[model samples]
Target chain A: MRQLSEQEFALIHARLKSLNIRYIEVYEEIFDHYCTTLENVPALDSQTTIAKLNETFACSVVKNMDKELEKSVSKQVWIAQLEFLKFWKHGVKGILIGLVGFFALAISILLIPASELILVFLVLIFCTTGGIYFMKRDAMNFSFQHKSVSVSSIAVIKRVGLLNSLMCWIWIMPIVLSGGNILSNNFFAIGMAVATILSIIYSISLIAVASRLPKSTLL
Target chain B: MSNNNLIKGSLQTIILKLLEENEKMYGYEITQRVKELTAGEIKITEGALYPALHKLEAEGLLSTEIQQVDNRVRKYYSLTKDGQKQVTSKMSELQGFVENLQRILTPDLKPGFNI
Candidate 1:
């Protein structure tokens, strides 16, 4: 078999990129297929080999790539949704534990002076901010690990990121804006509890999806 | 070459069976193997082969591993545990289909019947 030169491989890679095979995984697979098919051709020039490949592959490479991307993206979305469901299952368990803790704390608050509630509220604010910080940091770390992620995978990541940000804004912003007085309100406390649980779940799902992305190199 | 419609439904089965026998194969290798085995009578197009492989991978019936080979990366696919189990059922289904096709094509060959 005639091996391709570095220049020849570079040309093929450029051609594939030009053809808009943007996904790293798809590009690698197609590039390998082209190389294998063109390996032992009589004339081993890049243009000729590419032309022959196009002819043999019926000139529908781009269309096929688009189809593959569509299928891949849909599959990723489906898997992410399944992961989200799993996260929700665990979130519910965590919420049950939190509920038990909340009742115990409430009983303790009855015995303590009302002035100590402010200290308790301050601690809640500090923990919420720390949780959001860690969530963002973990997500950033996960994204950094895979440098060449596909558009579909990026879309999934972006979706989770958006939800995480929105949850933080919806849940955290009001408390910050009210200068911690919102904690005194029963409705605000209940809403914050629900939002915090949801934020944790979203953050976990985001990290899970990010980790599931194929490695940046070959893929 | 067979009509695409005729080959489409059985593509996954053919792929699974090939993986079962070969243990592992790359995309082009699988296509070339099919062509060689069928003596060029069956041509698996690039457009069809890849999507089928990806679909099977997404379905968890096949798993892939990448290797750097002679300056380029090659992605090899093999049957997962589920895929191994799937091969038997898929092959038998194809077998039944072929038998039914034969019966339709040659009604005289139906059991106990003579032309």
Candidate 2:
């Protein structure tokens, strides 16, 4: 076999990294599996028997790495396939969400009372649209599973956002449905509407911040 | 090699040389072959063996095929044309080094140990 150029080895190293493989392990595999004969002993000056024994222990990892390199797939295709799976998963989720939302909206329109019908219809529409928009945007972001993330922060922020968005929709839409009855004695409705808007904005901001936080910093 | 450092340095050469001769080999098969030839002196771990193999395949010095064998999938690796040339050059360099070392350490061998 030929000696590898530094550049060539580096390239191979990079590919291995992408595959999430450890380099030392590769060397060990190779040494253990292929380079065993006395004739194949590495060119090194030491106690003949000990050299072989030490090499078995030393190249233990290095040879394994080589053996792995002998067996694994190229880094490029592996990453491509992973990315494809992620994209497909995102697409499936979006479709399922849309279908379920649509079905609920249809059922509500047919069964609900006239006085409450239009308001419910509009709320459902707003939620479906907002969710679809967010889903599409998320798909474009393309986060890798291997990439780090802050789970606690993300969860907190997401919870806040969900609450806020929910409040925003439930509170404001009733008034708009009532054709903007500003002077009405609907005090509870007015307060709920105000709280909802505030919560929605808060949630949106929380999510924005959450997305920017580095994975390493995540709790 | 004397120790880990030397093995690390020459690992690629060894892999390239083996592939040059055999054309292709699988992970387990390569491991077994090395053990057999060395008489169980060199031991390779599965952990380290896989990554390096992957890296070479990525560099285009080697190519691969994944085939199902006995209900399990196995990935096979083979050297490219450039890899073949590389193996030749490395082997010659290693041969020269060994010869030089022999002369330096055994200066009297030419006449005194000729028998």
Candidate 3:
């Protein structure tokens, strides 16, 4: 079989990129496959081979490649989700310990005057928003680090971040809308507990998805 | 290539069985190997080949490793532990299916069946 020259490989790579196969892993495989097939077709030069390859793949090229990319990206996301679940499972003891310590602190805070409780609630809101903002910025930075990742894969990461933000909203909206009525009422502890739990879940998900982005770098 | 419909359902199994024998293979090598083995009767289209490979990898039945060869990267796929186990079961299932198919097509091949 004839070995492809550097220029030939570059041309093939460019063509695949033009077809939106931005993922390096997929791009390399398709490049090799095209080269090998062209090699088997004796006497065909690089230009003709490329044209033939394009013609051969023209029918379902983009559709099939996109579908494959989507499958692979979603699988990566699914694996990250599973890892996040595993992290939660193994971190259960630590979570329980934290919860116990938190409840003790909450009880002590509750014993304070209502004015102090309002101040604590305000601080909690500020901290939660800050945490969410930083987590999102970190995820976006991670996505940015991978230059050759497909648009679809980046979209997956964005969707996950959006979901985390939405979850944060769901946790915080009621507390804000009630104008601290819930905080003053008996449900203050329950509301805070729910918010804390949701924040923890969101953080785990963010970390998992962000961890996957770094692996998306081109080979 | 000739009987795409027939080959479609068993593509993954064929790939698994091939990897089971060959240890590891790249995408084009698998296609050529299939063609050669079948004497060019069964041509695995590139379109079908990649999606199957990705799906198998996603299902934990295959794993990939990339190696730089002659100034280019080649992605080679091999069966994982789960994939190894799956191959045995899948091959047996396919064997059973083929036997059933043969019996139906050639009813006389069965002891009590009559055409």
Tell me the whole-model lDDT of each prediction, alpha carbons only. Answer: 0.69, 0.49, 0.69
Cα lDDT tens digits, model 1, A2-25, are: 877777777776666556554567
**B-chain TM-score, every candidate?**
0.92, 0.74, 0.91
Candidate 3: deviation at residue B9, Å?
0.5
Model 2: chain B TM-score relative to the native chain B: 0.74
Tens digits of lDDT, candidate 3, A1-219 = 776667776787677766765455666677677877767776456678789788756646656765786777677666766666554475878578667856865675658654355455445545644554444442243453333454334545565556556655754576689875665665566555555555555555555565455344454
Listing candidates in order, what is each one's chain A TM-score?
Answer: 0.56, 0.26, 0.60
- Between candidates 1 and 2, the one scoring higher on DockQ is 1
Better of 1 and 3 by TM-score: 3
Residue-level lDDT tens digits of model 1 in B1-115: 7687788899999999999999899999988899999999998877888888888988889988988877678989999999999999999888888877778898777563332
True contacts kept of each: 0.50, 0.39, 0.61
Candidate 2: residue A17 lDDT (0-100): 42
Off by over 4 Å in 3: A39-45, A87-156, A168-189, A205-214, B111-115
